[model samples]
Target: MPEYQRIHVSYNGRLGVPVGLFVAVDHLRRAGRLSPDDEALWLTVDDWFIANLPEPPQYSDGNTAGVVTWFKPPLPAAMQRRVEVATGLLSKYGVPWSISESDDPGEIVYEDDFQVAVVPPVRGEPSPMPAGVTLGPTTGGSKQSLGTDASAAARRHLAYYATELADRANRPASPDRQRQLAAFIAQCEALELATILEVGCGGGRDGVALQEAGFDYRGVDLTPEAIDICSEHGLAVTVASAADLPFEDDSFDALWTMSTLMHLDGDGFSRAVAEVGRVVRPGGLVAVGLWGSEPPRRRVDEHGRLFVRRSDSQVRQALSRIGSVETFETGQWYDDGEHYQYFTLRAT
Candidate 1:
């Protein structure tokens, strides 16, 4: 048997270590090394950590034999305990490992021959890794640099979504979204609108569904990768920003967008709404879906993207400038316990 080597795994305050430990525990379970009670405990702890801890910015020196991540300082004591438990589990499995606050190698050897795997934390299912003792070359450093500038942050957010297209595609449509789509399709049928435009149609999920529902649907999104995925599915999509739509005036009978306009700030939001008004014909309908708040504010999501929360009154005020607000409601539409605001408006 090849000798197990002592490897230094660097982790900031994120859940990368616990996820790795999850993999390790799974390996032991498959090999019949973990008792039922211990396996349950490991899984419970892993779930707790994943639910409570924010995902860290993922990094790995591909050629190295360990994980790399960066975290904000003043790590909480609870999180530290979790990390200790993860490392303890690894030690119990006879995998020699150590945690470092910094990524500097100092004296530890992280060569390609060492049995280390640097797995990044992803939403949904854990990404698979090679079986048994296997090592792969380390790729380059972190793909993105953390920053606070609004424009740069927005760009990074789009890039992140572009990369996450596959993951999002695998996820089932949210119940609230399905409800919204059903309502929109009914409205289109009532209005006798044969053509519809979907703004910010990520991955073209809604577009495909709308087409199947017998409406001529065209989609637009800022991310090229999302557009590519939509094209592969045979949906008509264009790469364009909502702030500056490329269609002629009054090009469509109705427009539908959801959870996308929230990415724009106040000024960008106004511009995009103006573009929406310009694209839909007189007496056409527009359905807007967004997360709601009484006091509007801007915040960064887990993927380092900017999101603007608007109140129901604020949404009405914005859309009222272009037409009449026919319907408005806010409710907890997802498991996150946060309410989303949905509005249906008639273009004057």
Candidate 2:
């Protein structure tokens, strides 16, 4: 590999001192965390260090002889724990650390010291930070609670949607839509899937189907009304945000999220995706359905229900790095007199 160099680091407000990359890496090395054979990967500094290292560094898994590699940016956050989250390996290196068994040799990307890396905002798009919304360098401790705000907002949105469903039920899934859903389920059955977790499950319609079809599953929604409705019918359900699923890691075999993720605008969406990957087992499958729209359209419907809609392209881009995506299509669903677009995605 080309000489391994430059890693990214972001400084959060609380850390008090400025440190460089090599110094931080050396500390981990001396502490016997990173292997001694690895040299300080050159780092490019912005507000953070964007380090370019190997795919699965040699020091990674303590194989010291692992391939020398580089990354202009640190590995994405979801895989950070396994790789490492050096706040600034070049800096003072006061960030927290965690350890666990590794499932794959290539899974060695981490956010060391830097708990998370901000994905570049969509091309040429500068999203003015929302008033009162503060996003900064993350610490391992802080990341556990990363999407609390958006998840809270998401819950409220889900509640509104549930009420809308009860007060004015959308026409049942069309034969075509139901067929599509069933076909997806059939594919899962072929895989002998044992469990499914649905986030933003509204009124438990799909969950009910999954359960009736004999699939082991549980669901959560941001809105209590939806959870209550599902519970009354004796379905397993919880009122919680997508970013903060209460389940243990790798708790399920597959996950299904529909028309839910689009509600998160920027980094919140990314964090929620990370949470999904964290909670699902390696090689587990994930399926998502979203409405296709450009940017995110915020509006209130005639019944005073609010929605955050994004174009198909935007949804695909947001999820691109996480896994391979298949089956994206736009179709129409009739809800009363209105037409809604349905865009679906599946990844394993």
Candidate 3:
């Protein structure tokens, strides 16, 4: 059976936010204009959540992880009361609001007795960052209350990277990743490719390699924090989703995206691959990687995560929509027991 879930839902049809963040938006909006009474009520509810629940990392990190959380259904009497109180305040303010009471909310990040966090698929391109709304490197101590400046789409896009934690710094590339990099370079060597675009370039770790190889390396990622990190290392990485690369069609010689597409499951995944095909020149090479299974597993599990492992044939089948899969390989990421899948495809 699908798991029952409860969340302070957004109206965008795919995204949901916790009630705490929702209320924080209204409370902060009012507090800026000197509404002390609303501030007091906000404190009343905020204190309860802070004391009773473990705050999700996305909230603490200014939601740079691009994830929002949901509470499982069948709330305890104490918790249900808080939900009621939160709704009452929204009603009092005449603010639009909703509750998601259903199974299969989105791709869940983690779930426990109290709540489940999810990265819901975004509807269209993420909204441009509002002026004066800057994201920076942050510690784990503060909760950034959402303000009216950000749109629901912007919030969902932010939630997309919620699972990519802070530790994805410019660390040394693993041996398996290094080997995969060499393989990609070798595949492009005979063709003498010049420019490469990395979709979802995390921490510029691999972009640094491609740059050092004398290729003009450019990248795009959804997380602004990640863009900041990657740029510090002199990589020209921007903030954009894979489904919506900012470049024109047939712009680059090749593309590289590793372990990134899986986060965008179902239609989101397919659309991104098509977009990937759109940017790279026809007949150019594209390298794709993911943590996957050997026998070709592809399905949303009971927990709502897009768990996957595609056999080489299945991988070829997936790429057939846009190109021909030339070579495919899988190796266990020895540090963890999980398997890593790689593919080199020729854009059509």
Candidate 4:
């Protein structure tokens, strides 16, 4: 018989040592010294064992032959030497072992050459689409259907045109204007909300207005440059579309999307409205402001970027499927060569 060296193993805090024992076991099994069906495999490093070949059956009085329960102190040096010899012989035979603790080396829990598998956490299933909703085929495709101008120059040109459209539509608030708007939003919500979500927050002007009024606000915009401007001014904003917001459902108590849906037309607008409704909890207030016009109206603003112009009735019909609508059309008249309709619809 070949002489084998002995080693001691110990561990603390984690299961790293047990994994190591599994590795050592793999080597011993390969050398034919350790049988695949060995009963010792059932005993863990936390369990004590005698080194004799018959596995020294676990019971002390030798009456019973099951595995031992507790470990006792004052193990004989010869028994310890036998354990060291077993571990060392396994090691010399290129076997792998796993231990639970690092300080004492003889401890062995599991040993195997095969792969160890880990189970990942389970994720919840996606929510079902709402009633009366129709999703187009291209909605889930990996291609960009919109904003395809072919060339980089064309894309830049179109982007510039969009920016100009956004700018021409820009109506900055006077010093007292934002305060009144904030008050209006708070009144509509029926209470002071600590956190607010603003989708399609153009330029983040309204978001800033709300933040200044003491609400912790996060705004998201589709236009990257618009989001950049909002961030430049020290606002928490991100470039994200409203229809596919990067947030969990029902994450906010209040949502404010001001005059922002005019850009979305037809089914796109309807879907976005429904998505917003899904994200807001029951009885949560959503204040929507939009430019109103009769249906079948589409116009390119001064910058030549197209926008949908919907009447009050069309807007109501589109969103009513998701929540109750309370329309607020400001009677303030403006004739800047463009029809300006303001509404504040409350989502039930």
Q: What tens-digit string does per-residue lDDT give for candidate 3 at 32-110?
A: 5213333333343445566677777666656665666677767765565556556645654554566555577678877
Whole-model lDDT, model 3: 0.65
Residue 126, model 1: lDDT of: 33
lDDT of each residue in 120-148, candidate 2, tens digit only: 22213223433564433333121213223
After superposing candidate 3 on the true structure, give the runs of residues whose Cα lies further than 4 Å from its correct spot: 1-166, 294-312, 333-338
After superposition, the stretches of candidate 2 with alpha carbons farther than 4 Å from their true spots are 1-159, 167-171, 300-306, 333-348
Error of 2 at 308 (Å): 3.4
Candidate 3 lDDT at 52 equals: 72
Ranking by lDDT: 1, 3, 2, 4
Which scores higher on TM-score, 1 or 3? 1
C-alpha TM-scores of all predictions: 0.56, 0.50, 0.52, 0.49
lDDT of 1: 0.65
TM-score leader:
1
TM-score of 1: 0.56
Q: What's the CA error at residue 221 for candidate 4, in Å?
A: 0.8
Error of 4 at 341 (Å): 3.8
Better of 1 and 2 by lDDT: 1
- Model 4 poorest 10 in a row by lDDT: 37-46
